[model samples]
Every structure is written in structure tokens, then in C-alpha cells.
Target: MPPARSDDDTDGTRAALGTAPIEPPVAAWPAVGTPADGLTEETGQAKKPRTAAFGFIFVTVALDMLSVGVFVPVLPRLVAEFMGGDAVASAAMYGLFGTAFALMQFFFSPLQGALSDRFGRRPVILVSNVGVGLDYVLMALAPNLWWLFVGRVISGVASATAATAFAYIADVTEPDQRAARFGMLGAGFGIGFVLGPALGGIAGGIDPRLPFWIAAGLSLLNALYGYFVLPESLSREKRAPFSLKRANPLGALVLLRSQPQLMSFAVVQFLSQLAHLVLPTVGVLYLTFRYGWDTTTIGFTMAAFGCAAVIVQGGLIGPGVKKFGERAAVLGGFACGIVGLSMQAAAFQGWMFWLAIPATSLWGFANAANNSLMSRRLGPSEQGRLQGANACLQGIAGLIGPLLFSQVYALALAAPGTFPGPGAPFLVAASLLVAALVLSVRATRRPG
Candidate 1:
């Protein structure tokens, strides 16, 4: 028999007609485990575990990240091509592009969150996927840098996936189950980075626009997959009405503040996120300038980091959190970040730089830790808003991180008398982590 759709509205209509039990929808795949014995009494039917739904969300996240990753290697060069290959001018323009993208995310992500609250996660995610695909198409066909810029801005506005996806995870998973799932979400990021750049670089070597075309196809395909397979995690009773006032980015931050220790947790997330931006923003340039590494070598390093991330986030987080608890995991992750960034700052030898990858990869624990901790503070109705507010925080970090890292690195290079030299940015990033660790300690000490 065909599995019924799991839209919350449809769930009611079908139940009234005396159809199947009220379990979340999954595609008609083979069942793995026995029907859950735990929820049987309350639900009045044998319920398949919703981990299958979690699988769908995982694929959604991985594909979204892959699509975004496909363009990363080529974007600055594309901007440079528009600048007549003027490196300095292209650098400034690239920073502007990053800022503008973040600006759009800052303004729109809260609206996306509120919409998910009013409607449901599935529609919001579908819209985001379609928008991303369309945006890639626009970029691929762009005739000028400004046109590409517009495409980027649209992509930012379409950035609903992170907030909604996280909220969806929260809705389906139990409190104890959340950290591991969040780690899996982070693993999706690792998978994207591992595959996206290699594909992008190869395609880009043939034609700069080809990767964007590929990205477009991937996104559209993902949207189609979601349309057929993705179930609504949010139910009608749990959804809150959408509010423009609530959707305001500042208002979202206020929401974080209203909850106990939530603002402090936000601060910890912001600093850690900001610190982590060093790799993507200026990592390649730093390696070239300091270690005299070639593109192939840099690519391998990135792949190694990605693999390590997958191991740590996908495989290790659940066990580590289970044994040590979320608070210890949070602090330990920060500790790893501090040491890792410091290693990068001080590494004069190539092998020394490589060692930092595993250390830094373990820092993935901090992200899941913070997310799991914060989600517990909000009601199910407010989960979307909480994720939305966190999106705004990411936007803020995105706005600042790229520029900050670039300037610090650039000044380190040009200023001969300045100490720390090319390693200055890494040092600065490490310091940010140090601060984050201290704040996290205080945060973990307080009651929710």
C-alpha cells in the first residue's frame, strides 16, 4: 500500500477517515527495526521510528550545502574576471559581495523562520530549495558582476534551510536524541565541502560558469526530492501565527535575550562561528603566502579536514555527548578550537599545519552542543523562531568575519615591523575562541 503523506493538515483529514496511525511520513522504503515499543501505548498504533524522516532531512541539508559549496571556488575569480583581472579591485568587490549576501540573510532569515512557524517546515524548506536553484540559474546566466551580485542577494534571502531544518530536527527527535542528529547535520556540511570543491575546481577549469550550472541542477533535483519525500515536522497545534514584529532580526535577538542564559549562549556561538571563518575566508591565501603551498596541496589539506570533520561530527559526537554530557562537550570543543587555531598560528612547517586539522575538526562538537542546549529552552511552537534568531546571529558573524580576517591577514603581510606576521589572523581567531570558552564556562554553570 502507498504511504500517506505526513502533512500535519493531511494527518488530521486521513485520521478522521479512519486511515493509518498518526506516524510521521517516510517514503515507502524497507523498514529497518521493529516498530517502536515506547510510543505504542499513547499513539494507539505501532509507530515506525521517525529516524527515517531524519534521513530525509539529512539529504536535504547535504544537497543544499553541496549546491552552495560548488560556487565558492569560482566566485572570487568570476568577480575578478569582471574587474578585468585587477586583483586589488576584485578583492574589495568580493568583500562587498560577501557583506551584501550576509545583509540580505540578516534581513530575510527571520521572515523565513516566522513563515515556518505559521505554515510548516516542509513548505518553507521546499521554497528555499527552489529559490536556491533559481538563484544559481541566474548566476550561471549572469552577464556581469552586478548581475551575479543580484543572484547572491537572492540566494541569501532564500536562506531558510538552516533555521527550518534545525527546527524540523528538534520537532522530530527527542531531547536526548537531538545532539547526535545535529552532529549529523554538521556532517552534511563536511560531505558538501569534501565533494563540492573538488567538483567545482574540475568543472571550473573547463568553464567558470559550469559549476554554477551543476549547482543549479543539484538544487532543483533536491527540491524535487523534498517535494515527494519530505514530511512536515511541525504540526498545526504547535505552529504560532506569523508576525512581522517577531520576524524582525533585532526582535529575534531579543527573543534570545528573554530566555535564561540563551543570550550568553548566543554570544558563545557568535564568537566560535566568527573564529571558524578564518579557514574559508583567507585560508588559501594564508597557506600560499606563508607555507608556499600550491593549489593541489591546498586542496588535499581541505579534503583531509573535511574527512576529519565527517569522522568527528558524524561518528563521534553522540558517544562523546552521551559520556561527557553537553556541558563538557561544549567546553571540550572550545578547548580543541583554541589549541587548533593556536597550532595554525604557530606552524612554520607544512606538516605542523596539517596536524591542526584533527584538532580543529573536533571543534564540530561545540556547534551541536550549543544548538542542543539552546533548543531545550524554547517550546515546540517557538523552535522556528529560535532557529531563525540563530540564523540572524550567523548573518552577523558572516557580515563581520570575512572582512575581519582579510584585513588582519592583509595588515600582517604589509606591515613588516608588526609581530606575528602572516599568522596574525589565526592568532586573532584563536583569541576569539579563548573568549568563547570563558563565556561558555559561565554559561554552562548557570541553570536554564
Candidate 2:
């Protein structure tokens, strides 16, 4: 095992690796001709601006998530509409939609990341935003299942925006500041979730197709706003040539493996992402089966979950990281996940189910901390590639997660007396999370 890295050794590690120091001296940060110059000027933060480029990216992420959330409340019914109202068939078809999206993301994420590295963050992001807007419009106008599937494919291809967004964040922020910034980003997602589902449910209640139009409008507006205000974070000198070998998903994973410190964290990220799929895959079905929750009730529950996430990621992550360090934060967050999943699995009543939401929100701490850890290990030029690889990993997990959990849930439902109840998927999630926790602990303990 390599020796553990201390905070004090950060600069030394960067210097020894011949990489730019992760945290340059404050005086050097705003120096003319430095990479930070554009960021500083844009934010008017001679020091750290109150709201810098990251703030815009944060809003971009929030809006992106909001568009996604708006669709959630009505997707099942939409699927059922095409499937002749067979709930089981609709559920199966919905999993396929999710899988198609993930499959496209898996193939394209690294390509998008590599493109961002070569071209620039701004164009890639803007294009993705435009694509998402079109996708929403397409979904809204879909006349049949084929059209819906086409729309999903387009949406999946455009989903590469997330990887580019993370790469943008890494370009502008220092390593030590990354976790907090990522926490803020996660908070944006939380806020989006809070507003999107609730509003979507209301709109969906009135007209099932209304939310998609609204979502499409939001995506277009977001794209227009970004075109005017978003600045390029990657300096020309830092740009790398794009290569097909580096752009493929398998190639991306291989590139990730080239970094010893990143491999374990990547695996942990994969497992955690897979485990999280339980929420989207089985969450609605489980609730409906177990508690007879309707769309409105499920929307409210998701909003509440988003609220808890907002509180924890926005409010607690920075302090939690400061108090216990990234490793501890990661471990503690995973611990919370274990507890939350277990509680969710055992909860028989609605109130008991609600209680688990806040507990699971702690998982955001782990996500932000792990991202920070990984970001710090790479050089500026490598950020896009790394993030893209991570995105591909996430894509793979997303592809597998829904299918796995849905199958498990279906099987469990079919044999309720032999298996756990609707909450059986949570038990499976808890088990995966346990493995992730163990891997995280071991990985963090190892020296870089």
C-alpha cells in the first residue's frame, strides 16, 4: 500500500508529479496570464467571488435536473398510455427506456468529455442543452412508443452535459474547495428535485403532457442563458487532442485504471450509483404496492427527499468535511446510507418510510467527498477525461441498476410470502451499499 496523504503534503505531491499545484498561493491565483485570470475576472472575485462561474454551472445543473424531474411524475402513465394500460408491461417498458438512455450515455459520455477537452467546455455544454430542449419537445409530441423511444435516445445522448459540467467545475475551483462546491452542486440538484416533481405533479394532474412542454421551455431558456453568460474555464494551453481510443467507454475505463488512486474510488462510485438506482427503479412501484401511493403522494415523497438532500448537501457537507476530513465524511455518509436503506427496508408504515429520507440524504456527503478526492488526483488537462470516465461508469450503473432492481422487485412481489415485501429492493440496495462502504474505507486508507 502507498503511504496515506496528509493535507500538508498536497503541494509536495503536486510538485513531485510535475503537475500544477492543486491550491496555488492566493497571490498567484489572480495573477494575469494565469489560468485563474479568466475565472477571477468573470466573477469579479479578486479573491473568491460571491458567485463565480460555478454559480452559473450550478444553475445550469439545477435547470437540467428540473427538466428531468418534471418528467418523472408522469412517465409511468405515459408509458402505460402506449402499453394499453397494462401496469406490468408499462413497468417493463419503462425499464427499457431507462436502459436505452443509460446505454447511449455509456457510449457517448467519454466522447463528450474528450470533445470538451479538445474543443472547449462552453460549446459542448451549450449543444447538450439544446439537445435536451429538443428531446423534451420530441417526447411531448410523441404519438407512439417508437417516438418516445427515439426521444429517450436523444435525451440520453444529451445527458453528457453532466460530465462536462463537472469538468467545468474542476477547471475553475481549487482541490480543497471542490467538495464544498460539489456539495453546492448537489444542492442545486436537490432544489431542482424539490420544485420539479411538485410542480410536475400539479401540471401532470391537470394535463399529463403539460409538464414536458414546460420542461422543454426551461431547457431552451437555460441554453439561451448559457450561450450569453457561460465562459470557458479550460485555458488554451491546457487543451489536449481528442483521440478515438480515449473517447470510447472501455478506453475511458482503461484510462481511469492507469491512475492507481482513482481505481478504487471509481469502483466505489460505480457500486454506489448502482445502489442508488433502487430509488428510481423500484421506488414508485414499491410505494404503490406497499402503501397504495398515487402519483401525487409519490411526488410529495420525492419532494421531501429532495428537501432533505438540499439541507444536507447545501448546509452540512462543508462543515462535515471540515470536521472529519474527506475520508471520514465518505465513510460516515456511507454508514448513513446503510442505516437509511435498512430502515427503508424494514419500514411498514408511511411515516416510517418518510423518516428514512433525511437519513439517506447523508449519502450526498459521500458523493461530494469522493468527487473531490478524485478531482485532486488529476491534472487540469485530465479533468474532462476523468469526469467523462466517471460519467461512463455512472452510465453503466444506470443501465444495470433499473433492470436489476425492477426484476428483484417484480420477483419479490410475485412471491411475497417467500421473499421480503416491496421493500426487498431496499435490502438489495443496502447490501450493495455495504460493499461500497467497505471498499471506500479500504481505498481511503491506502496511500496514493
Model 2 vs. true fold: TM: 0.84
The residue-by-residue lDDT of candidate 1 on 1-448, one tens digit each, is 9776666755465345433121212322112221111123344453443665677678767876676677778998999999999999999998788788778878887888888889998899988888888988999999998899999888878855788888888776655457788999999988988998888888999999999888888888878877877877766866888888998898788888875577888899889889989998899998997889999999999899999999999999988876556777788898998899999988988899998988899899988988887776666777888888998988888878988999999889898656898889999999999899998778776334
lDDT of 2 by residue, 7-43 (tens): 6686465445433212323432334433423234455
Pairs in clash, predicted candidate 1: none
RMSD of 2: 6.5
Candidate 2, pairs of clashing residues? 2-447, 3-447
Q: Which residue window of length 10 is worst by lDDT in model 1?
A: 29-38
**Model 1 C-alpha lDDT versus the unseen true structure:** 0.80
Most accurate candidate by TM-score: 1
- Where model 1 places Cα greater than 4 Å from the true spot, the runs are 1-52, 83-88, 414-419, 446-448
TM-score of each: 0.86, 0.84
